[model samples]
Structure formats: C-alpha cells, structure tokens
Target chain A: MRTILILKRLITVFYYLIFIGLIAQLFRIINQIITGKIHDLKPKIFGEQLDYGTMSLFEIGLSGVVPVVLFYCFFQSLIYLKRSLKDLESGNYFSALVITNFKKIGILFLVCSLGEVIGKLLFFIVFKSKFHFELDSSVVLFFIMGLFFMFLSEVFQKARRLQQENELTI
Target chain B: MLAKREMKSKELAEIIGITTANLSILKSGKAKAVRFSTLEAICKALDCQPSDILEYKED
Candidate 1:
C-alpha cells in the first residue's frame, strides 16, 4: 500500500514534469520561428547546412506540425497511464474505464512510434538530407509497456468476472 | 424455519460450507439462482425437504 502511494506520487510528479517540458518545448519552437533562429540553426542536408528560406511553406508547416502532434500523443498516453494507475491505487483494478484507458495508451504509443519514423522519413525527403533512421529504445519500451498494460487489463477483466461468479455462487 | 428449528445462522453456514454473507444473500431473495449442489447442502443442513424451503411465484 505504501509502495503504491509512493509510486502514484512519483508518477504524478513525472506527469507534471512532462507537461512542463512539453510547454517549454512549444515556447522554444515558437520563439525560434518568430525570431528566425530556426533558419540560423544550420540543419544539415547532404553534409551541408540547408537554408530554411529555400524550403517550401508546406515543408516548414509539416515540420512544425509533426513535432507538436507527436508530443500531444505522447503526453496524452502518459495521462491515460497515470489515470489507470490512480484507478489501481483506489482499488478499482477491474474497472472497465481502466481497461479502456490502457487500450488507448497502447494505441497512442504505437501511433507515436510509427509517426516518429514516418515523420523523420518525410523530413529527410523534403530536406534532401542524409537519410538517418535508428530504432529508438524509449519508443520501443513505451510500445511494449503499453502492450503489457493492455494484457493486464484483459487479465483484470477475467479476474473481475471470476469475482462476480464467486459472489453469485451461493 | 431456522428460528422455528432453533438453529443459528452461523452454525448453519458453517455446516453448509458457506459464508454468512452468502446466507444473507439467499435469505434476502437477491440470489439470481441456486445450484443443485448448494440446494442439496442447504437441505441436508436444515433437515428439510426442498419443497418445504422453496416456493415459486409469478413475477
């Protein structure tokens, strides 16, 4: 019980941190765009700095939109996970809401991972840059953890059914 | 019947291998259905006929 409380508190803290970090990143990106710092940052393409002015409006729009969408999805997934943990802490492990949230988190993680890969590919093509792709461990971990929670939700569903049967047995 | 037979609910529950809560569920008529095995156990513990303890009424 104490461990659960501590974990809940820790997750809450992490949730706040992630929220703040996302906001900070958003501000930073906005500042960069407004101040024309993005153009000066020297984003490399084919071993040379690509001038942002040369990029089309569509490419720039996509670059900005993709990061924001990825962050939103990742943050929302964490929010769902935190809520599920809160349900568990309250001894509502077998709740349908928890299961739904878990499934949502799983799907969001999968989407984030796939979106990251596709977004990078699009960026590479648009910039005519060195094609760089690497399997990110954190994204993989999140995806696996999401799947595990989804599996746990199913187990909880079965356990809840058995509990009901036991209650009705006599 | 239990009152007339001077039997305690606790003792009956112990003999029938069920909890007092389950016994209460039965007494309250909240149970959806009763299994034959449980009905048999209850009948044996109470020393009564199934008919003596059960009745049907139209909803």
Candidate 2:
C-alpha cells in the first residue's frame, strides 16, 4: 500500500514534468510571437532543436502522436493503480488491482520508452539534416527512471506473494 | 526430552519474516505445510532446530 502511494505520487510528478517540458517550449514560441515584430517572428525550424517546433507534417505528426500515446498509457496506468489501492484498502484482496494491472503498465512503459527513442532518432535525422541539436540526456535519464519503476514493480510482486503465503498459513 | 525455550509467537514473528498469525498457525500445526525457505527463516530467527518445533507423540 505504501509502495503504491509512492508510485502514485511519482506518477503525478512524472506527468507534471511532461507537461512542463512541453509547455515551456510552447511558451517560448508564444513569447517570440508576441514580441512587437510579428513579421520577423516567422515560424522557424532550427536544426539544433529536438522537438515539434516547426516541422513538416510527417515529422510533427509522429512527434505529436508519441506524446499523446505516452500520456494516455501513463494516465491509464495511474488510474489502474489508484483503483487497485482503493479496492485493497477497502478490504477487497481478491480483486487486487495492482497485481492485475502491473504487467500492463510494464508493457506500456516499454512501449513509451521505445516511442521516445524513436522520436529522438527521428528528430536527430530531420533536424540534424539542417542544424545540429545536441541530444538531450534527459530522455535517456527518464527512460532509466522508467526502468527503475519496472524493477520496483517486480519487488512489489514478490512482496505480494510473500504476504499471501503468510496469510494462507494463518 | 523437550528442553523448552519459551517465546511468544508474536515475539518470534516480529523477529522473523512471517507474521504472528502465521506463527500461531505453525505452532498449532494447523498449517498445511511450510516452505523450506520460510522454515529456514523461522528456525534461524528462533535459534532452534526442527526438533525444537515438531513435537513427538508416541502412539
């Protein structure tokens, strides 16, 4: 239960980071567009950017889709975990939601990580063809964080098994 | 000869990985079976042998 709460809180932070990262970029754009010279504020795709800033349809479309899928999968995992914890605390062990949704979350995280990697590679290809943007280390860093969660899920599963065995003996 | 080593199940359980409730079940022999790992952990925690645990009844 405590572990679930920790995970739940972390998910909130995770989503917040995602929102902040994306919105910061948009705000930068907003600041540029608002400056007195709107004519000089033509949409520009810098070669050094790793984003959906100013790009052709196919590239931007792929970038746009990844974040949507990542968010969808992440929120779905969070909701499942929340419901699972609520059910358990209300004394519904038979319907332990975490155990049920654990595997699905693992799968989604894997997919999300893959999407991130692919998006990074795509950005590297498209943008570097114009100008050089240093690859962001934060991408791999977050993916490592995802792996840490995956490892934790395994530990939770083991702990659950031990708990169940103890209960059965009683 | 049962040289007794006295300890409450709860006390033993706190020291061990298993719960007091589980220890109670084991002590009463109501437990269906004990896994070797759990058994080892219990024995180690209690500082005793299986013979210290299992009672002998001569029929």
Candidate 1, residues A1-170: lDDT per residue as tens digits? 88888888998999999888878867976898899776554444323455667667576665567667887898898888788887789887778888788778878887887887777777676666567675678767866876786787687789878777776867
lDDT of 2 by residue, B1-59 (tens): 11254766667677766777777787677676678877777678767887777776674
Which candidate achieves the best TM-score against the true structure?
1
Q: How do the residues B1-59 of candidate 1 rate in per-residue lDDT, one tens digit apiece?
A: 78878999999889989899999988888787788988999899888988988888787
Highest-scoring model, DockQ: 1
Candidate 1 residue pairs in backbone clash: none
Q: Provide the RMSD of all predictions against the true structure, rounded to 1 decimal.
A: 4.9, 10.4
* DockQ of every predicted complex: 0.48, 0.19
Write the residue-wise lDDT of candidate 2 on A56-95 in tens digits: 5476554446566766776676665555656555555444
What is each predicted model's overall lDDT from 0 to 1? 0.78, 0.61
Cα deviation at A135, candidate 1, in Å, is 1.9
Each candidate's interface RMSD (Å, one decimal) is 1.7, 3.2
List the lowest-lDDT window of 10 residues for candidate 2 chain A. A38-47
**Top lDDT prediction, candidate number:** 1
* Model 2 spans > 4 angstroms off: A1-60, A87-96, A127-137, B1-31, B34-59
